[model samples]
Target: MEIARPQTDARPSPVRGPTPGAVLALLKPITWFPPMWAYVCGAVAAGAPIGERWYLVALGILLAGPLICGTSQAVNDWFDRHVDAINEPDRVIPSGRMPGSWGLYIAIAMSGISAAVALLLGPWVFTAALFGLAFAWAYSAPPFRFKQNGWVGNGLVGFSYETLPWLTAAVAVLGHPPSWTMAGIALLYGLGAHGILTLNDFKSIRGDREMGIRSLPARYGAGMAALIACAVIALAQAGVIVMLHMAGLDGHAILIEALVAAQLLLMVWFLRDPVSRAVLYSAAGVGLYVTGMMVAAFGLRGLAMPV
Candidate 1:
């Protein structure tokens, strides 16, 4: 069955400025949590005293979440307006709530603000934010438009959301690159995030097929895509669990093992009815996934502290 797409007007509206609620909707505050949480995990894993310069920590969280992440959301929504007419018509741009090319304007302005804030945090953080902003534009805009291909697109978003902010915060606290061990852990979690992101593809298969978006579900079919997504997530976290055990953090490894096991059970349910249950699995599974991230961060922090 063909999904009905809402009628959309591509012409910019004449409204001078959209209301603040529209702007907020464009920025998508709900999408901010992942990167923010990753930043905090990095800070904790760095094991540096934070109370003295707590404000810097706070700033890093802002850069990771509301600034950089929010900017990405705006950029995505603007470029995705057409696809969203079918997948999510109520979105700011597609719904005409953000008038007069305001979505693009906000993305550009937020990119600048994110850069300015990142520069304040220091060069490494600034560099990370630059890469994030670059990915944001490329993932959505012309010339690159990585979102056309699920593999490249999901990889970029996962890394930007998980790996980049993580290292940025770690360097902010450690005043340099993190130890390879910490970097490796962050990489693993970011890789797992790819699968988490793929879960989002299931929601838009009809629209993506019509729009040539080639999301996992659109490309590979729901059951196969669900299996692949679960595999990617499981393998990535399996690597983390092994790394933790090798570091003698047996208890933390055990906790993540339990989390993964629980997630596996949830995956079973999601796989049985992938289209309707995708969001449900994401809610339950991602909670456990991020919990494991924090648990591993604590393990790293414990390793950093001396007896």
Candidate 2:
């Protein structure tokens, strides 16, 4: 049975011609970067050391993340035109730099290409790519509007970004996910994603409040949101440490865990401010922690073998 996808007419009409810059904005660069990096790190952490076939893994994930993230952002811009006009009038669609319908078409095209790349990776990757598309569409769509439901939306997006990609990387290199270790990693990764998303909501709280979007930060206010972000990061860091110990990872792993924990502590300190500088700091911490952990895992693996 053929599943009928929605036709192009079902998409919104854009107000104007597409500008090169508008198309660039649809890429959603910030959202794309971490997922790709995480996938690379995940392949390393899953016992496939970086620098060999890692490029293929990185290429697959690089294609997948941009397609997924970009498609989601374009769809979001389409649905958010009204709100954008009020809060972000300079945005592509609202500013008349691009049509919403065209953006949707672009999204569909990007996702199609993403799925194609996933297919090249074989069945497991294809399956994950399908899920990524489904979640991206359902997130901001009518009835599902996952983001409107506070933590539910946060969890959904976070899990999709964090755990799903981890699974993809694991499957790509190992032909399956690592048994016994996945659950703890999934939990900690999900928490990290949730915390990051909440920080995003904190930044957009004013606009969200005015637009009547019930984001976690909008509902709880900035201080409480900051507290929640701190708690989530702390818990996730601890969980990673516990999981490493349980997995019998050596002192090198413990060292990496401690560094990540300290990084989180620094991140928590800035959650209260959430200024542009703070957001950059948060991103740097995440990148550093992920990179550090991957390097440490590979380092330990090296030491365990014959010299």
Candidate 3:
């Protein structure tokens, strides 16, 4: 017997094309902060004088946040409209706010726009953008829809949102590969963001399960998943602190340790009711996590500066 799929409304396209406002809503501007902030951290970590390269910096930020990240959001929404119909019926695509295949069209259009903007940034930035854009599409669309598996999906998102943008910003600013220290920090932080992505899955557990999406919260019970997320985040951060100490960035290590401590405390509170508190933990705990990232960036900058 064949497995049943979730039934989605077959809505017709609007007589008119998507409005500008509907297209903007499809981009999900609120989801842009993490990548943009990561790009800024990378720029700081590059230890380059930005006095002459302000235009490049600005363009890199735009690419990271609005173009690349926004494109991902649009693609995910377009491909996941059926799931969103159950999880968030009010969403623009599912609710017919944009209607029919317009969501898909918008995503495809944005992908081209992102590539054009990336090429203007630099070859390194353009290469990173292509990788990010590829992951964005693979995460949501086609036979390789990575979102079906929780770990793979979350890991891809973490790397795309954090490490890729960080590398792009560093290359844009310094016109070379970032130092090993900066690269290492970006990798760790990107890995740690797996937990953040897991937390986001909490909000869609019901829809994910019903639609046969194997998100962590849907496959493993929310409580167990919460514990796993806490462990992943805490351990990765512990590794970062150790690496910082080994590098003799004592002040930065201490600051990051304090931030991690605070995140652990918040995690305890979040675990008390994981499903209900996922958003709160994401906003509060993840905020501290990114702040620590910025601190580490500043420390790397000091080390990268000329003696």
Tens digits of per-residue lDDT for model 1, 1-307? 9999999999997657889999999999999999999999999998888898798799999999999999999999999999999989988888889986889999999999999998998888888889999999999999899999999999999999998888888899989899888999999999999999999999899999999988899999999999999999999999999999999999999999999999999988888989899998999999999999999999999997676
Clashing pairs in 3: none
Clashes of each: 0, 2, 0
Q: Best to worst by lDDT, what's the order?
A: 1, 3, 2
RMSD of 3: 7.7
> What TM-score would each prediction reach against the true structure?
0.94, 0.83, 0.94
Q: Residue by residue across 5-65, what tens digits does model 2's lDDT show?
A: 8867777765566777778886677778656765665565566545666666866677557
Clashing pairs in 1: none
- Whole-model lDDT values for every prediction: 0.93, 0.70, 0.91
Among all windows of 10 consecutive residues in model 1, the one with the lowest summed lDDT is 12-21
Off by over 4 Å in 2: 1-16, 49-55, 264-268, 271-281, 292-307
lDDT of 2 at 23: 88
RMSD (Å) of each candidate, 1 decimal: 7.8, 9.1, 7.7
Ranked by TM-score, top first = 1, 3, 2
Q: Top lDDT: which candidate number?
A: 1
Better-scoring candidate (lDDT), 1 or 3: 1
Error of model 1, residue 7, in angstroms: 34
